[model samples]
Target: MSLKVEFDEPKCVAAGQCVMVAPDLFDQRDEDGVAIVLDDSPSPDQYDEAREAAAVCPAAAIRLVEG
Candidate 1:
């Protein structure tokens, strides 16, 4: 299985929910509060958790695609 993660900067509200949910796959830059995608292409073990983080993002900034 292949999974992809994408984050939209403009739409992000810096809620930090994504980072809070999955710190391994997401992060917060010191300059900007907006969440950043650490490993947009996460490993299989992180797939479900990454998806969960995406789902919990209040700004809906995370996008996941499965293949």
Candidate 2:
């Protein structure tokens, strides 16, 4: 199993929810606090965390694609 994480910068609201939920996969920029994807493809074990991060995003900026 493989998981892919996608971050929509323009849709992000700097909420930091994704970072909080999955720090290993998501981060926030220091300048404007925009969300950034640290790891687009995370290990299978991290799939749950990735999904939680996407679900917690208030702006719906995080997307998780399973393959």
Candidate 2 per-residue lDDT over residues 1-67, each given as its tens digit: 7788888889999989989988998889999999899999998888898999999999998888888
Q: Total backbone clashes of model 2?
A: 0
**Cα lDDT computed for each candidate against the true fold:** 0.89, 0.89
lDDT of 2: 0.89
- What are the clashing pairs of model 2? none
Per-residue alpha-carbon lDDT of model 1 for 1-67, expressed as tens digits?
8999988888899889888879999998888788888898999999988999989998888899899
